[model samples]
Target: MKLTLKKGPLYLQVQEILKKRIISGVYPKHSLIPSELELKEEFDVSLITIRRAVEELSKQGYVEKKSGVGTTVLDNHAISKLSKGQRFSEYLIKEGYHLKKEFASLSTINLHEHAADLVEHFGDECYCVERLYTLEEKPYIHFKHYISKEVTLPENTDLLLDSLYEIFFQQGITFNRFKDEFGTEIPDPSIAEILEIEQQPLLQRIRYSFDINEKLIEYSVAYYNTAIHKYVVNFDV
Candidate 1:
């Protein structure tokens, strides 16, 4: 397939194209992908660009490269095991599960002392969005997201129904990296009620997302109902 290459970085665009092909089984598991020369000629891009794109695919577990051989697609199970750290919501969708997010509340609020420390420089105010995540139409998790007011959110946008990162990208706000801390805790009464559980230990994740400039732009706490879903984290040795 010819890539239009009209948007985003050349390498990222190429990566997406190749990833789609692999996921759709166009290039079946263990099948060799086109060579660098072939891909360069096909995309009309430089060898460096093609190499970078392939490297990204390898890092994401879509393909594996071997010396004296070639790049080959990995099986779906292998791919799932190798994706380093994926967003739970995105991961669920990729696993062919129906996922939905419902907003319990969305509003701007004065940041409490605890929240103020999370986004160190965001002053004393921020936007707080509470949401419930459903997997296959059943409650699976709950999330409370606190975003820096400095990062402008689009008015009238349904923060619950849309991908927050996508919305931020549209407004020229993007995260370069994020940090996550995981722990187990008994859910509060309100949280337990939302997750449709009773006196159960929940997996909790505290995530801090930073912009390209390394500024903390978002802080979120998520509680997972492990009875309904499992959280997996992959590490490369």
Candidate 2:
């Protein structure tokens, strides 16, 4: 069947198509998926694109690849915990958690000197949005986002109800790639109180997102309460 690809990266489009097929049982559990050459012909995309899409599927645990044999689908339930390309908030909601986001603060700020190199192109100032997420009515995640001033956030947008990424997309901002750095730290008193923790450790993640033209668009830091929820990362061989 011919696939109508979307506007983003071809591999991502193909990945979504294949994932939908797997979830819909079009490619049943343990059944072999279309070979690379066959999928290439079907989608009229390059071999590299086809391979990347399949590689993503394998990494997400939807399928497994064997050198001699073709790719085989896995039980969807077995891979429900797999998180490959979703935002952390999206992952939590997909996992059946009741999530609520509250805007702790939203204002413009001078970029810190230490992180200045990360968004040097955006100059000295940027808009900052701080958010707190409650899962099951308890503090679960805290996010601090720094966005380039050049990228306009909608004045009519509601940060509490709408997704930041969705707002960016609506404003014609398309992400090309992202770089993430992970670390662990003990929260300071101020942050600890906001997170409702006394002395527990927090999983820290800093990510920089760039657009298709290679312009830095956003820098964000997230602190996760690992005692209540776990972070899972999947890597393919």
Candidate 3:
């Protein structure tokens, strides 16, 4: 309950300590947090410090405070921690590749020809978020994501820096396996600039579908710079 800020700034240290405890199941989801007065005594910190730490957690959707109810822990298994199953980026990072991203667009749009079928599955309600991945600032891949309107996205968030999977996870969505298809192609001018490859550098086109709660909720298409990224998927038996 009490922590000494010995390694980092006081607020960040407080944030991490509380976050670890919450993640460790010390506070289960929907469980009310200790009152502000209780936490002040627990951490021996000023009210201002405790307030700042709690605010940080709130921004990440880890905790909520109601008018009469004390702060409560939000279910966040999907956002804060990666599931036992790995993501493609996680797999790449484990292979020692540096990863970064630049956002291009995140908005709602009418379904287009190529995306029409996908849109129908989601009941014609969709949000498109686009971003370009990079390695140390050089454009390496372009990602376009489509999500159902059932998932509420925070307004004006930067997709390049934020993880879409994490966003959906916090909304109580999870993916087991869907469908994926990949091939090589020449990039259109727009995708070319977004990904920052040569005029034509053997673009790797990948389209993936996600299964959420036995419903197909998302579809995405990505273009990767062949020279910089080696997209690989392994199957066990």
Candidate 4:
């Protein structure tokens, strides 16, 4: 995979990608990740860069280095959650469902359309991206993400290739907290057409993500196709 040069340090970008792999169970827990030389070949970076990335993961408790056995993954899902429980994607993935997000468009837009909804929580100007998530190759959710004006989005961002949060991280914006509101609504005709839904009530979720300073970083509204799969939330005791 090619690393973006401007996403902080090259090693950090490699570390974040490796972190995602670990979280997704690609490099399963208790398994050894690739050797520094192997990772160097995979990422087309120097051995020092791979070593630093691995060392950073090790320091974060995701892995541990052995004298000769190389680094081994210690945990698979150590990443923080948006709320108190697992997200719908995590729940579905755990249930053996394949989920994919298809990118439709990414551009700047005014929040005038959402003026009657949650527009008060965000600035009038934002970077909007329209995405549709699929489950088992079937339309499942219509997602609209409105990123804060504080982030300067690069033209090369591919929402289908990377998670939107990860893309935001590339711009040096990190979401530390999120507020979610759930409701039922009849989505707009365009969103209805994208999700292949009739003009009927559907499960809706509004999320506002914030940085450590409590400033809004992202605002998103998602409409789920409840006829295909109901939204699930887990509670861990």
Candidate 5:
């Protein structure tokens, strides 16, 4: 895919971008990657540069190139480890699933006590973003994110399709430590409507995230419809 990010050497950037796509299940395991000519055209680079990037991916154990069969992606079971955290979405990618997420709604509102005194870190108001994730057009997970006032969001919600962590990273707010509380709860009527499920017991997850300096930066909750799929996290040692 073509991205506007220009970082480091062109070959290295293309390699990293392709590597991320492989790990994120875009070019899934055992699938044939685009031709060298295709990638060269996509990145607007030389064929030599494209080959160099693919060579790096092969050396890194992310792909295997055959004589005439082209290049195929390798298993990405260690994606979570590479990403520095064990997340459900990463695990799904590893298990060969394409997950799509979009903003359902976004608003700035006064922080409430339910967020455990988030006002101390974000004063009175915070950005509330409602995100819905679908697998093959079937809605399954609903995420309600409360971001700190310190971080600025995009004026166009369409530009916020990436994960919150990626967005936070762009704003110089990287959260390294996260605490997750897992349980089952009857979702609110509004949340149930978003998930396309009636009010029922759904798997819930609460995340308290901290930045490099151990400062709490975000608080979010996610609801999962287990009837469709289960959440799996794999640990690498």
Candidate 6:
């Protein structure tokens, strides 16, 4: 492995190098990390620096250490890397699957307590919409969108089945995404019913926030079924 510390702290730089290799499959999941003494020489850094780097990697969910068993890379099952400016809808279209949309509901209501804070960030009056997207008749993604009630959308909104952002852009409302978070978990009972998934670990949840005209105006949550699809993201280290 090539190691250089021309920029950033030596230990942080070391951590990035190791993290890149691990995520890129240079070091596969559950594979053992090299001995500290070996890494010390490889990076041409002091042993303390090597140890600190390893510790940092552990904190970031990259690796784990065991007594008398050395360090092991963790399995990163969920897609965690992303290209700088790739759009999920564009990626899906490139895969040759036709995305279809089924609108569930759209209404103005008081924000549920769980989503109150995010709703407040947009505005006191929030409009919510629910939708399900399918690829070639196979149910794919379930999404709920919350936006400022002040911004009037179509009386009957149609999100083009393939791209919600496209509609926003066409309406001259450029979405400003503030947060994007994803994780793996068992499907909620209601979600499981909707997705027809019958077991645990069948779901991937994504929550994001966006601003309109420099004002926070949208918060969205999407649920994806992992049993039928896998996510892949490519990023430059």
Cα RMSD of all models vs. native, in order, equals: 6.8, 7.0, 13.2, 8.2, 9.1, 12.8
- Where's the lowest-lDDT run of ten residues in candidate 6? 76-85
Residue-level lDDT of model 1, residues 1-237, one tens digit each, is 455557768887787677657755788889999999999998888889999999977866668899889999874322332235564566778789998876557778776654557545677788887888888888888888898787676565465567676556545663556777899988779889988789777899988887647888778899998787788653346
Better-scoring candidate (TM-score), 4 or 5: 4
lDDT per residue for candidate 2 within 166-222, as digits (tens), equals: 566546665556778999977667778889899677899888887757887888888
Question: Which candidate model has the greater TM-score, 3 or 4?
Answer: 4
Cand. 1 Cα-lDDT: 0.74
TM-score of 2: 0.60
Q: Tell me the lDDT of candidate 2.
A: 0.75
Off by over 4 Å in 3: 1-87, 112-114, 198-207, 233-237
Indicate whether candidate 2 or candidate 4 has the larger lDDT.
4
Instruction: Give candidate 3's error at residue 66 in angstroms.
Output: 42
**Cα-lDDT of candidate 4:** 0.77
- Give TM per candidate: 0.61, 0.60, 0.57, 0.63, 0.62, 0.54
Number of clashing residue pairs in every model? 0, 0, 0, 0, 0, 0
lDDT of 4 by residue, 1-237 (tens): 777787668897788788778876899999999888888988899989998988877765678899889999986553343544566788999999999876667777767765434456565767777788899998999988887766766576464346777556556554446788999999999889888777899999998888746787777889999899889988665
Find the candidate with the highest TM-score and give its number. Answer: 4
Candidate 4 backbone collisions, by pair? none
Rank the models by TM-score, top first.
4, 5, 1, 2, 3, 6
Error of 4 at 174 (Å): 2.6
Q: Please, what are the lDDT tens digits per residue for candidate 6 over residues 1-237?
A: 545556657887777677667755788998998989999888888888889988877765668889899999974321222224344655677788686686566778676644668654754557777788777777778877887775666665663343444445444453333566777767567766777767567446565545433576567777886555665563334
Q: What TM-score does prediction 1 earn?
A: 0.61
After superposition on all CA atoms, how large is the RMSD of candidate 1? Answer: 6.8
- For candidate 2, the per-residue lDDT at 52 reads 97
On lDDT, who's better, 2 or 3? 2
Alpha carbon lDDT of each predicted model: 0.74, 0.75, 0.69, 0.77, 0.77, 0.66
Tens digits of per-residue lDDT for model 5, 111-189: 7745547888778889888888898678989988888878888877776666566666555553435788999999899
